[model samples]
Target chain A: MPGTRARRSDAEVVAAVRAAVVEELAEVGLGRLTMDGIGQRAGIAKTSLYRRWDSPQAILLDALQAGFPQEQPTPAPTDDLRSDLIEALRLMIAWLTTPVARATGAILAERARYPELAEAVYTQVFEPKGGRFTGTVLRHYAAAGRIDPDRLTPVVLDIGEALVLKYTLDSGELPDEQTLADIVDQAVLPAADRPH
Target chain B: MPGTRARRSDAEVVAAVRAAVVEELAEVGLGRLTMDGIGQRAGIAKTSLYRRWDSPQAILLDALQAGFPQEQPTPAPTDDLRSDLIEALRLMIAWLTTPVARATGAILAERARYPELAEAVYTQVFEPKGGRFTGTVLRHYAAAGRIDPDRLTPVVLDIGEALVLKYTLDSGELPDEQTLADIVDQAVLPAADRPH
Candidate 1:
């Protein structure tokens, strides 16, 4: 096995390990994710894995943190809040289709069994990636004085994500482009927009 | 068993059957729920159950229909969109704690396996009572000419339930009163209120 593993570069080994963790999370889930299992899947040595990370959860969290997508708002505030917000949601929907998102969902579905790991997902994965889908967009405009900064309360920030997440949960499908626009125009913008 | 069941009123039998379905649903979920199990739990005969309902899912849908709560807006609305919204969200949180809620969650968690039953949850249990927790309150005020009727779009109406539902999904607990108030003030009311 060592001879077959070859002298792969450190970057190559890290990339392989990251991909393996995504698949491992979906297949084994929160429980039963072991260093040995990950090592075998990534074609790396368990001793080598231990040299870099301590636990399987740690490795999984690293991949999630690395894979989480950050939303971008348009540069120099065009005063078109609607388009920027919709673009942010589009980024979110695109990310929702990835292997990393599935891995995140897999961990969340077992929140009761692995409460700490679930918390880690929020703090380590989601929070660092803009908290919610429209958060960056809302905050970006708020910072530009186009929207009231005080209006970016947790509930306000959550409107787009909550509705979009609710739709996905209820329908088992991500919101379409029109649905995302509906969320932005009807929910997020109304909640976050400054009064005329 | 027959001796004990003797002389029971139709209402009494139906009540027993209703409670039995709730418990049966939690234990066996949608896939394994059966007439035999329900009859035994309710202390009614399988033939008696068949006389009332043709399928176990039908019996479950009936119980859910009976248990869904109807949210009440302030009789006059009194221009208190905030308080009414908070109350409506409170009603939703209360429903989420019921055994019927657990049954619904069990069904929804396996939506891929029982897609039709999940749809039935929406059309049968949820829609008849109200589309969302805040739907009745929003429509009531709109009818009174306070909020714009057009503001009560799908995303607007869903603001309360979506945030409450998302909160519960993340925390594994229902939103407290203060958080409900945040949802009203920060998200729901702003989206539903008439523009000045």
Candidate 2:
């Protein structure tokens, strides 16, 4: 009964650090995020954190990656590019409308000051998943003969990124299922129909 | 030369203060933007500045509004929706790539703390121009019988806002002229084309 409190494991400690970064970012914003604060919040020793991450920026980047969904959504072989694109758009929009979007915004703003953090994010978290998603959608469209194979990747990236950016920056409105459907019908499908 | 350096007029003082705000923002970012800094930089009496604006945010907002483009781009009716949309997108992309974009980003990031500034920007800068651009594009498509008359407004807003947001938030990559042309030919035209 005296030793009832559960001992936190190494993986649990890492998760705590990651969650603490998001909490601190939301509470105090990127301007005030510090490694010391993260250590205190995570209940981990400062030396332990320093050994793991070179700087607060590195910690922040790690936190962001840890927060991302483990299983990336893949577009199914719907054979209809429009439908598949719509579903993909919906998944992206859903992610943006969540707490993840706020954390992302903070990281992006902070990245202006810490170029290494930005590069890490671009290389590790942002680029890989976004690239994979785009590639999958484009390959499907290309295989179905819906879009020119050459333009598939660029078009998917452009349209998908635009949707996410628009909601995040301009309107602050989430692209709902209906909106995604409309975007696919109006923007993606038509673009795919163009002659090479 | 000493005589020429005599006390400035009211308009000159205002201009100096606005310029000081911009310069300070560029140097230290919005986090360090302050009225004291502005007064010192502009060589203006602090009392005079207080009389003009109630707070640093007010002064910054006024300066921002003064610097924003007053007139929206005129959408030329190219007799084709694709051409008109491409021209519009090009202009929008160019605007986002300028210094104004950075200033805008700072303001948006600050808006969570200052709601009044957000409202002012939305009403004065974003809403009016966004409405006009979306309306014009939709009108062009409607006239050509390319799109359903009813769905024109939403489609234009969705696509236009998406493109603008993409440039602002995600990659800062402006959709090139060729991409714009392709978007119009494939997406806009097809979306407008209804079932016969």
Candidate 3:
């Protein structure tokens, strides 16, 4: 009995651990994150957390992969490019302001310490959620020969995400309805629509 | 010695302190920045630093105002909006990747702790430098009746700067000539040009 292993390898434990990491990260941020604290928060034994993950960064990478919304919400197909882009960008704005994305501010600040984690967040989490807007919606528009081919690249796609990020960074919140409309009406629509 | 005031108003001392803050911020970033370290780096006393500024945030605000490039370089005039926008945005790309802009990544990371400092840096350093591109160059083009009046606003202006910042954040450097050209050609020009 003294040497026997307890019921481990439960998938629920993995989910709990990941949720604890994310919750702790949002509250205390990455600088002060600790496995002992995470184990406590998750109500799992310290030995359990240590057995599964090598470091806080390793857990963070797993948590990020789990915590991010698995699928970007598909925008409804509207005949108008403007409506489709607006809906897509609104989804992008909401995603950027999520607790997970907000928590990454701490990671990005400590990028020098955890370069791999930062890069993973950018590549694994951010690019895909943000990238789907262009890949799915804009690509469809371009395929219909509605948008200029020049506007189909990732660089052009960055325009909307960057605006939302910059606005949130400045104001500490997602932009309002008027601002989103301005982005879609004045920038996104103009930049993509093929000349008649 | 206590009776008499030491050389209290030397511009050189203030300049040295500000310069030291900027240099240290670039090298070690904000998390490791310390008043003692700044004093040592500036060859000034801790008492002197404390006397001038209440906290590191105060010093950072001062340094940001002093550190950013005062004027955005004006590109040469060209016949077409494409050439003009390309040259203007090239200057923008260079300006964005400067040490001062790169250093703000640290402040941005710790935005919760020092919101005012972040706002000050944004309003004073970033807005002015990034603002002029839209206010001056783009305004000139609009004035010439080459572009729509509705396009001349702060929101639309953010697209170019935001794109540059995103590219820098992702790649750890400014966009290349091809990327810059793509942004200007596909995004900026299309958004600004008027209908025939």
Candidate 4:
């Protein structure tokens, strides 16, 4: 029972630290995020936090990844490219509109003031997930002869996510079915499809 | 001499207040933006600011518009829809990458926490400008038979701005000429033109 309690308390401390990082990011933004503030907010010992993470950025990285768990693999495409794109975008929309994404957006919003952090996020957080997802889906379409090689660039791959991101950021809502469908049929498919 | 001095002082106050608003929004974001903070930062009386604008939101709207002045009209489409679309998208990139846009993006990044403010920005600022530009250009293309009537919808019209917005928000840079051209040629123009 003593051993179980010790392990349980440690697990709670981890969760608290993760939540505090996200909460602090939302409150003060990346420019002002600090280890002292995070420790105070999480009610954890500063030394213990320092023992685990090297910097506030490191804590933030773990918090974000923890908030959006990577245990679930991105869904693979089936036969239909259109359906696959729709499904992929739907999952993207779900993730981008989550509490974690919104909190991360708050920090990223200050990118002009904190370019290093922004770049870290791009390289460490966003690009890895978004890029991998885009690459996987685009390659699937390309392999099936549905998309041209020239059309497989980053900008084209970003079309669906970009549109959905804008709409979600603006409206604070994942777009309705009609809007998502239009993005897939009108924008994504056409951009990726081989031009006649 | 007295009249001239009065006008000059008023102009300075306006400039200071506007600059302060932009700076505050950049530093603390919309959630923490307050008149007291802005007044102290701008070196103006809080009462003076309150007299001109009803709320911090009003100050922000005025500041954003001031920072990204709207003197130049969005260019109308010429006979060549492709060239016209290119020109329009170029202007959008310019505006979307301005400091005002970046500050606005910072506030918008917290939309989940401040939905009412987000809606105000959408209705009062973004939609008004983005909608007008989209409508004016799309109508021109549609009337000239360059674009299909059905393609005159909002989503299709928004593809260029949406793409540019995402790129600007992500990289804090206006997309390069090639990226803009691709959106026009590969995405916007093709989407608008008669479907095969």
Each model: TM-score of chain B?
0.93, 0.69, 0.72, 0.79
Better of 1 and 4 by lDDT: 1
Collision pairs in model 3:
none
Model 2 sits at a Cα RMSD from the real structure of 5.3
Which fraction of the native contacts appears in each prediction?
Answer: 0.81, 0.47, 0.65, 0.46
| Model 1 chain B poorest ten-residue lDDT run | B1-10
Clashes of each: 0, 5, 0, 0
The candidate maximizing lDDT is 1
Candidate 2 lDDT, tens digit per residue, A1-196? Answer: 4356688888898888888888888888877888889898987778889888887767777877665543232445435555556666666666666565578766666665755655677687766565433345766557666667765535444665565455555454566677667666656655555544
Q: What is candidate 1's CAPRI-style docking category based on DockQ?
A: medium
Best by TM-score: 1
Give the candidate order by descending TM-score.
Answer: 1, 3, 4, 2
Residue ranges of candidate 3 with Cα displaced over 4 Å: A1-12, A26-37, A45-58, A70-80, A126-134, A143-150, B1-17, B24-63, B70-80, B96-99, B102-111, B126-134, B194-196
The candidate, 3 or 4, that scores higher on lDDT is 4
Q: Write the per-residue lDDT of candidate 2 for residues B35-67, one digit (tens) a residue.
A: 889898998767889999987767777776666
Order the candidates by DockQ, highest first: 1, 3, 4, 2
Candidate 2's C-alpha runs over 4 A off are A1-5, A24-37, A46-59, A70-86, A97-100, A132-135, A144-148, A193-196, B1-66, B70-86, B97-101, B130-151, B158-161, B172-196
lDDT of 3 by residue, A5-54 (tens): 46656798998888888789888878788988899898887887889899
DockQ of 2: 0.37
Listed per model, the TM-scores of chain A against the true chain A are 0.93, 0.78, 0.75, 0.80
